[model samples]
Target: MIRKNYNSLLITHILDGNFTYVKNGKHTTAHKGDTVILDCYNPHEYYTENGFESIWIHVSGSNSYELFEEIEKSNGTLIKCKDIHYVEKLLFRIYDSIKGDTPPSELRISVDIYKLFAELLNFQTTKSLGENNYEDTVQQIKEYISDHLSENLTVNELAMAAHMSASHFSRIFKQQTGFSPYDYVLIFRLNRAKFLLKNTDLSVSTVAYKTGFNSESNFIYFFTENVGISPGKFRKLKF
Candidate 1:
């Protein structure tokens, strides 16, 4: 266990077991394959639990904090790695660069580190937003749909909200989320329908209308096509 403050951000990769952070009467756990961030301004207690091991890297320079600050403002948290293989490859690359012992200035290691951080931010944002690009727009769309799934949705209107051309939005949305805009809207409606069916006593026709389906037949057709069962059958199974 170690702690220090520098002009740059530090990243620690937990290779085995777990680590804990204690501050302000709260404990946060980072298990194996997890990564943690050490900010330059925050002082906190950290320790390994259950025989933990980790690799750490310190990055310091004039612009080091600047990059981290930008990432923090955009994404908030720095500890994210669900896959161990990805973390291992990143750590190996950083170690190899440090061990190469080439001219430090010639290596431009800080720039590489910033790029890695950017990639991590993008990955986390994409995973959370359900799309790789236009994350802010995607998040907005999700919120709007969640709040107003009963209202009719059009690709033109959604693209306008995203501030992009309809065709362009459609293409990029499918590329990022693996679903066309229409299909995603349908999926949202279907999911909400299931929730209402299971939890509420609304008639099938009412549920279909509230979920933006034009008719009970259309709702049943799509529900059966996508869910492999009619909404009535689904409700019965739940009951």
Candidate 2:
């Protein structure tokens, strides 16, 4: 089949036979147990000489575009699921949900779509680590970040913990986790700050310091920019 410039995302799982997928002048062959994710906003074609069988879905709305872009950036548009059965299960759940007499809830469909994305991401992470022999390095780096949240963290320091150069570590970290090292650190700090603000009576300044920000003003600025509210305001909400 041929398609282009459509405003939705397409995910297809190849259950039988084979097909050639061409996107942006690149050709890929997908066979049984493989999945193809396409941003229909681009010109693409996929067809089989002998025909093929597959389960497919089109997804749009909410954070679908952003999530698909992130996954494609890290893992490409095609993947061979390590657990194709689980992938099929998720697809079936979505299909069944929409086919029921009572219309499915938005949350239910979103959950399944998110799970499919997670499965794709996890597969990519495992594939990257296994192929590159970074078996324990990424996990170690994440643990180090968590353990040292109360202190300043840098790409250089994180690379040292992973025993790789800054550039190389940064590349692998983004590929494996779909986020740069700096963004990862920032997100981790924000999460910790939120937790402390909500769970403890610590002052905003103390929470800021504990999460590795240099000053309360800087932390407040960062939090407000990302979370859309001040730390004190976030804490006041009944979460």
The digit string of per-residue lDDT tens for model 1 on 46-107 reads: 64424588887877666766666766666543355546577677666777777876744435
On a 0 to 1 TM-score scale, where does candidate 2 land against the true structure?
A: 0.54
lDDT score, candidate 1: 0.70
Error of 1 at 117 (Å): 14
| Residue-wise C-alpha lDDT for candidate 2, range 1-239, written one tens digit per residue | 57888989999999899777767644455778889898888898765545689999999975888888888877677776789999999998898888889989889999999999988866866554466466357756876887788798999999998989999999989986668999988977886677678768999999998899999999999999998999999999873
**Any runs in candidate 2 off by more than 4 Å, and if so which?**
128-239
**Candidate 2: what lDDT?**
0.83
Looking at model 1, how many pairs of residues clash? 0
Q: What range of 10 consecutive residues in model 2 has the weakest lDDT sum?
A: 127-136
lDDT of every model, 2 decimals = 0.70, 0.83
Give the Å shift of residue 189 in candidate 2: 52
